[model samples]
Target: MCGIFAYLNYNVQKERRYILEVLFNGLRRLEYRGYDSSGICIDSDLSQPSIALDPAENGLADGSCKPLVFRQEGKILSLVRSVYDEADSTNLNLEASFSVHAGIAHTRWATHGVPSPRNSHPQSSGVGNEFLVVHNGIITNYEVLKETLIRHGFNFESDTDTEVIPKLAKFVFDEAKTEKGEQTVTFSQVVLEVMRHLEGAYALIFKSPHYPNELIACKRGSPLLLGVKELSEDANGGTSFHDSKFPTMDGQPKELFFSSDANALIEHTKKVLVIEDDEVVHLKDGSVSILKFDYNKAKNHGGLPRPASVQRALSVLEMEVEQIKKGNYEHFMQKEIHEQPESLTTTMRGRLICGDSSKAKSVLLGGLKDHLKTIRRSRRIVFIGCGTSYNAALAARPFLEELSGVPVTMELASDLLDRQGPIYREDTAVFVSQSGETADTLLALQYALENGALCVGITNTVGSAIARNTHCGVHINAGCEIGVASTKAYTSQIAVMAMMALAIGDDTISSQARREAVIDGLFGLPNKVREVLKLDDEMKDLAKLLMDEQSLLMFGRGYNYATALEGALKVKEVALMHSEGILAGEMKHGPLALVDETLPIIVIATHDACFSKQQSVIQQLHARKGRLIVMCSKGEGPLVCSNGSCRVIEVPQVEDCLQPVVNIVPLQLLSYHLTVLRGYNVDQPRNLAKSVTTQ
Candidate 1:
């Protein structure tokens, strides 16, 4: 839920101002991940220190210069203001340059403590503030570790689990020095030792005066990547790295950027290496070396592995800077909502074949082609995800079952873990997530893996953990979704899953015509979405009418049931309103009691297999004098709203299975408008992160 960014340059001089700007901008790019506080730590100009500090207070036994740390309890702008304010008050020269420097910055989403400056990241050790560490995920055993450190006389300043990391590193560093006598104990060694005692997911960057001009970045069950910028003037013009070739350790003008998200690094360098689980990367003297944590070796060395380098190839980030920008839209959520038409098109690109005349319409998902045979033979297919991803799976579930003739089950990743559900080798588990780094989903995936079930990933992120760990899967290719509330990615996920269904059901002769109809619907879906977006102003008008309402209720059945859930989720998530999505059949059971003339209810009456049931629901709501908002097919509003009293949102009709794609657009617009009217942050939302990286 937090964002981690660090900058290091070797043999290349940079002014403190530029370094600060880099760090600040990096954090700004990752604001989408959601954070309540921000902080940064940079090398202090040794010759002219900015902040005066006592040796004991600063944890500098050797009287070394303490790093410049600035932390604020609000946005990144607040942290920037504090830094500039301090510079102006102290007459500090930010233009002062350093030939070799390192800095780490973080935007923290509070977990261990409340959002405050003391709880912000760039958390330091107690003794001398010797080690500064910025972390992304939770530390499950922090209480135990904190108790040990407290017994060792290490006091803490903040109530964060992250505070223990630097303290732990210092403790390990001191013990290593004690054991080695006069022998040098490297930062990597101390970090490796620290990793042994840590339990939980985290992406960490460690900086210390004890090991100057070096930065150690590591990750376990969290996302982290290193961007390499070599200014060596190679024949390739430093644009791309050779395939599978590691950069030389030669002394060259180089810069290294580390971030929990690729969005922060894409602008600086496209050539990056995704740090996998349990891998530690040490950057020093313009050279980068990777070390893998080995349980066997660690057990032998008192739970600290000896240094062993591992080879990893640098992958080119395919995303451009422009993809993350909000463009003419007011918010990322708005931009993404409006981008659905193009995103759906992108999801179907090169995969849907209309079969001009003789080819016979078909769907080809290259990622799933090799695994289709195995999937078809599986006893069952389980779809695992969280939030919007989960809803998307639900929307695609019925069609997948119809096409593949394989029983499809939906699982919320967390629930699956809580149940430790039975997953057999004959089953195929599909994990869906926009970021693919969702902690619960990844943990569930691990559970499925241990059970010998084939795991598949459907994600928008390319180098995410789910994408890397899965046997095979599809990329949603919905572009960068920067909003905490998903829009385009959700639709794209459904489209991809629909295609997966088509690919699996292609062998059935009886369903040939049905498959071709779906393919045609898939081809026409984007246009239908484009047509439905014309209702934006109408939805906005509807939102205005319901802006002051206390609650919302949505009802649907069949495929559009997911639409109802997703629509209500959008309202609750962004509009800051209480909303519920009810199945039409279950409305009378309980949800109907909540309906009244004052309470707003949205019913999906779109033409589908469940149209009659939805129509019956509308009639029941009308009989109860419920405030109704019906999302029906264009020109079919009269059929559902015969009384002419219920507010109607008419959307273009598509194949019954594909109707969710068209049905969701207007609701997304309504939610966006409602959020703006309710004075809530449309993109960030309150207390929510774009990627749920922690349980």
Candidate 2:
């Protein structure tokens, strides 16, 4: 939910206007990564270290933005535009006035305060707005900092941890501005100085009225980096870029990259140098250098997470509006949801997936062949992930364990980090992550890789951190899932995991059958998805029928039992209703107490070995007058037959291990439709940033 952009003079004589064009364009590229509102301050000629809360009006070469405290209690970007437009009716380009040197920009995903223009970033402080800054990550002890500042008679504006930076930097700048004026306590110095007094994670960049051309930047427990490159500059030498354009000037983007995902800077450079915690970087014209602010030796940490290859690949500076159009579909979400049936087939696209004895899967075990062999001979496997990704792993766990005949355990990555778990060289660690940038998941994978556990990654983005670091695994060939909630990717991963398990357990099938199943399913998928779409009309009615449900109880048995858990999660995430999932049998032990006409219960009765058990479970709920929605097996109408109160849905049947693969489709649809029914943005849920980069 946060975005960072840095601009430094690239070509010596490029107009500031061109640089601004590119900068604004880059910000637009970053919009998908949801932010409250964007705030920026550029050292253009019209304004020196001027702050634009919401950059409606462009900064100028000589003039700085007015120090107005914009406090609209609405969205970040929205309030920002109103403020920006109000700040100045005309958004005059100030790039030409000052020889632009370097600066940082931000589109904040607010973790603090409401999405108001006042709470926006590019926080400015000092006697006359001498110091300005933009920040990401949470400053945990902000209240304490706020109290201390108040004691010092320091005034504050926004209720954000970021505001402290500009004020604190200004304090230091004033204290050290006169002493050693040049190279001493500049805005960069103030940033480092203020950092000493703060606690928690942050990636920050600052500018000083005293020293306008140079930029001060640092990071700690948060993502930030120097592109170490140059870009087009205004006449005054100011550039709206941070990398050296020429390959040789590359010296590598001094890794302190602020990128949460590599897409931001892949176009600038692939070579990266990591910025360790407490590292201070001063980016100046014709020179890029690092200084030990506290004179403390930086810890040389090993096993630094490797950047993913896809993260390394840069897009063509813009997204295609056409790609998002859903082509022939009525809604983007619906089109994406339908694309899964084919997307899943595509994941198995290159591989041989014939589960039949006639044709076997062409199991391409990345670097895990030896590991898989060991696991085949060893004790067990641990499957882990977070959020929907965790559910994806949960869906694959039973199948992998059953097919491979190896006990597999699935847990959330966040859990493994907080608690010690059973991980051994004898046990293979299979982690599932969509972005591969998940911090906790990365740490969990690190613990496995660092220790001797064989780590396998089933990630969507090809070159993400987890993909690069794991002991080698498959890429869920579902290219670029832009919708943050993850549709096509979720199914593709389940497919890959299912196939991998089957291959490991029984590699006797011929490639032809595996390919046929995948191709047949794939070719039939768009149509199948179309058929599923036909159910949307029915699903919408279900949504309307279930509108009064304050809570839900769901259950499943066997391979898809996890789907019950996922179903409840979906309802909760979108519908904002309280729901719970447990085995139907477990209902008597506890959940049964919650069962009443008021608590609607959903049972995953999809045809599997557990159908009879699911029926018994359903009878118990039905007897108790528990409201129900039965997800029955495709052809088992007799098994699914319920009285007038319960609605029954018969979904397509696949292999037992692949039930989740097929069954989850309907649940995803149910979640999507219900969320729309609840009037929430299904794609970007409020307060949930797309990527959880910070712990």
Candidate 3:
């Protein structure tokens, strides 16, 4: 997974100086999507444009007219610092010189290359820096293309598939000029030709000195959206193909913005276009055009391609800006972890209702309201997702099965694709993801669609691929989760699925008592979450005790087994430690071998059908001289930890089926504090991304 952001100030207006800040802020917002390294390249007309370079390499001398480039091996903030530091050391006003109207910025999640400064994006295609490219998605046939380019005297500095793109552009540019016996070919012409050679999913943005006023972007698979800012009559008679209704800024009716996600541009503009597969977008000083790729048609029509006569509609963002910012919090993870109470409220608002006992408590989910009959009649209910989303679905499986009396199955989206899992028309498959753009989940949804299964999407992103493609769905409304390690989204997903189960159960009379109790529990979940948040100080204290442990194990049973797994995932993901979540029942099978006084194991013994069994698990672990942290009901702590030999974390009891929702809060806090205490990045952990957009 990766993020791409670009901007073009066509009017060369005074606001041009803010280009770097614009790109910098955009990348910071997109950081949750994923990145191992970051970089930016700005337009330059000077034969000697100055910019920061890798610390390992000697930066180009000022006055050498070339695109200014800045790169770093870590987060986007590191690159920002490098850019400012370079400005301080240089005689040239690098910031002022950086005001070239067009540029691209990238945050890379490595694929086909190692995570290093050399592999950072803003890859160059021409020796003179004629073409600079920033890309998202893979180039499957890059090796072959690289070999060919190498034979043509193209050299590579980074082991990246993206490097092939720029080199290939240069190759095409040279080949075309040679064939025509001419010295010049338009940038669009060369790009169009390069498109004929590319295969696989890619969203690309590039700029050339030969075409200084334009930023060209296109995509085949990875998501790309375009935002237009209108200009006033003084600027260029602001014209927007969609509507041109917004107030113009500084004479220019609009500047253009491009990103992998609309979240990146919410602060700039909400009016945007979602680029379709194989469509090319050209943004110039005053005009923007969307082009369709038709090589044969282009060849027959003097190398000029047809524009997409179909004007794609623009959509407004429903998300608020405050949701994406971390207010009065140290990190997004902490803020989001603490936001669970409100998040759960937003999730269940108007969905679960409470009244007189004889009135029959009920749940109403509009998205699934019509599909409940179909779902109840389904032969099987398959839950599909990846990473934390998958764990969320697993947590809700027991509730779905017990309440709806439906056979339920869980599948990791990637594994499902690999096995080509059977999905019959009689089955209902639910796709869950925080950001609906997850490539693997999308692919799995496609497979499920092809097999004729009824598809339901559960995600936070409103118009994402999964949300749009599925026949029915629910939005978790978790708000913008900026941390790479998911917290709120997972809980919100569980809440939404729990609501779905409750809604389906209401159709039958035998389940009335059980369903009503669950509805009451749902009504109180938000407050219960608030009470759980009180465990923060306690969790922090406990984190200090366990910070030095090399490995930790978590145990839970039935509905809570999923809680154990997700708890382990959060710990391992952010704390950078070895952690495992094991079914308490599975201990004697093999996990028992790992128990010892030096090893810390957390047991979820909250009141449930498996309470006694969990008590036995605690006894077994204690008998083995195992260090333990037991999570039990507030009052049952005395019952489960009667011997008073182990430390216990008490959580208020909710309906047994919804207990996992409450039980998980303390563990999430522990992981957060542990990650901070361990001196790790709690928000953006290494080797993890907020959304896993690629397989």
Which is the leading candidate under lDDT? 1
What tens digits encode model 3's per-residue C-alpha lDDT throughout 8-59? 7664453424777899999998987666899998744456455443211223
Flag the better candidate by lDDT, 1 or 3. Answer: 1
**lDDT for every model?**
0.88, 0.63, 0.82
Runs in model 1 lying further than 4 Å from the true structure: 47-65, 233-245
Worst 10 residues of 2 by lDDT: 303-312
TM-score for every candidate vs. truth? 0.96, 0.76, 0.90
**Candidate 2 CA-lDDT value:** 0.63
Query: Top TM-score: which candidate number?
Result: 1
Ranking by TM-score: 1, 3, 2
Instruction: Sort the predicted structures by lDDT, highest score first.
Output: 1, 3, 2
Task: Give candidate 2 regions above 4 Å deviation.
Answer: 6-35, 47-73, 87-105, 125-131, 139-158, 164-181, 184-296, 299-332, 353-359, 446-452, 506-530, 642-645
Give the backbone clash total of model 1: 2
